[model samples]
Target: MTTDAQAGPITLADVRAALADTDPSRTNAGALRKVLGRGSYATIQKHLDAIRAERAPAPPEAPGAVPAPPAEALHAIWGAAWAQAQVMTLARMERLSAERDTALALAAAQAQDVAGLAAEIDAQAAAAQDLADSQAQALAAAQGVALEATARADRQAQELAAARAEIERITAAAAQAAALAEREATIERQTLQAALERQIDKYTDLKAVVDHLKPMAG
Candidate 1:
């Protein structure tokens, strides 16, 4: 927990402690900011977002569920409309051919009018084709956005996983180091005890020899 005059770097441990008593569903930016002092809403939000992102696993693909069209319902509606237009265009051509035949029996002026109507139909078809092309372009753009979102999610998952693995490795290494230190301390204690015991034995032997020599000298 490090802070400056106003705000500071919010650690993962600090965030966890702040939310320890709070309900998971109620843990929002405001709630976190209340417990974790000195950070702005954005700072709290950034830490909270990272916590959630790290905790969340990547969503699994639904089995047997078809991937949705890029444009979703809009694409389907437009596709159906385009298909209907093709059918109507064919029917309109048939009607125009019958009308042209009728005009041929009537006059040159009516035949000219039928030619105009055919031109209008061709223009409408071109407009419909243009609309379809625009929709296709829009769908492609949507697909690109979806792909980018997916890639971002995958990257986050991988980074979180790596972080967890590194933490575990550090923890295991610390435990091993601590155990080694305790063993070394125990060995040093035993060595000191053995040295002290040897000194005591030598002192006892010298005392006995000194006592025996004093009686002889006497």
Candidate 2:
């Protein structure tokens, strides 16, 4: 009957009838609108306020004292307030959830960057170790070559010393043999001069005896 647009207007009797089965303490205007299916928010609120004013008790005789509304009107106000609070709370929860998702994405990206840097550091350390090993091997080979050269030099020095000693010994033996041959030649020349002087003296004595015998025979 309330949903009929051909009906003149929404009446207080219609609102009172709708409130009969519903608890105003736990419901909002939108849900009541669905049940009635006719009135706009302005029309519903005007009627709701009129009902609350009618239910409020008279002011007390005391000074500065206010009157309390009836239980039904109070519950209706609280119900509208509670509905607004629920809407605000849901919106805030949605914003907080979006911010949390963004933060999680940023943290994941930073972790990937850190992993890449660590890999680069490990590669550099491995390359440095390889270079050190190669240098050590080269130094060992150079030391081996230097040792062989030193040994060859020592052997050559020993051979040169031996050759010099042999040359000096041969020179000393040749000097001794030349001195002995000169002494034997001097002795043979003296013996030949003495034999020639004795032969001349014998010839002179034989000639004098023959001259004396020829003078006696004449």
Candidate 3:
């Protein structure tokens, strides 16, 4: 016959006992407080909150839907995406290099043609000085075109490298977010399970008390 006031702390058992002694017509916080003796309103509210959380229904899953993927599944998805991106990047680099090599080969061929024109100019300088001057202008233009092509190839390579770095940064951020979400879900599930267990124990103790009193009443 320990009173709630003398007890170390208010427990689910104390709350159940107070509810049992309260008048059915006056089943309210005030009535329960009277039965609980020195237990404060806050103590009664804490147990009530626990009961509500325990009895709360679980959220229903979508029909035909699978449960959320685990952390490893998320990691695998990220890895697959990363691998695919790398493949595409490598292919792009290869194509760019091929185009650069083709441009360099074309430039080399044009320079060989210019060298043949120069030899002809030297052989017929007095008779075709004007023609040799025109060929000189053509050679300069070809050289300019070749330099421009080389610059373009360099720019493309730089751009490709920047794009790859951006993709890697985004992938890492996504993986980190997924890991954090999984951890939070795990913590929430554990907390809910613990609350449910406490609720079950409270009800079991209340039922035992009712059974013990039944024999005496009979």
Could you estimate the TM-score for every candidate? 0.35, 0.43, 0.38
lDDT of each: 0.85, 0.76, 0.81
Please give the ranking of all candidate structures by TM-score, highest first, separated by commas.
Answer: 2, 3, 1
Segments in model 3 whose C-alpha atoms lie over 4 Å from true places: 1-131
Judge candidate 3 at residue 146 and give its lDDT. 92
Predicted candidate 1 versus true structure: per-residue lDDT over 135-206, tens digit per residue: 999999999999999999999999999999999999999999999999999999999999999999999999
Candidate 2 per-residue lDDT over residues 92-199, each given as its tens digit: 888888988998898899889899999999999999999999999999999898889888888888888887787777777777666676676666666666666666
Minimal lDDT window, size 10, model 3: 21-30
**On residues 30-112, what C-alpha lDDT tens digit does candidate 3 reach at each position?**
66677767667887777756655655689997799678899998999999999999999999999999999999999999999
Of the two candidates 1 and 3, the one with more favorable TM-score, higher being better, is: 3
Clashing pairs in 2: none
Among these predicted structures, which one has the highest lDDT? 1
Q: What's model 1's overall lDDT?
A: 0.85
Clashing pairs in 1: none
lDDT for model 3, on a 0 to 1 scale? 0.81
- Model 1 segments more than 4 A misplaced: 1-128, 201-218
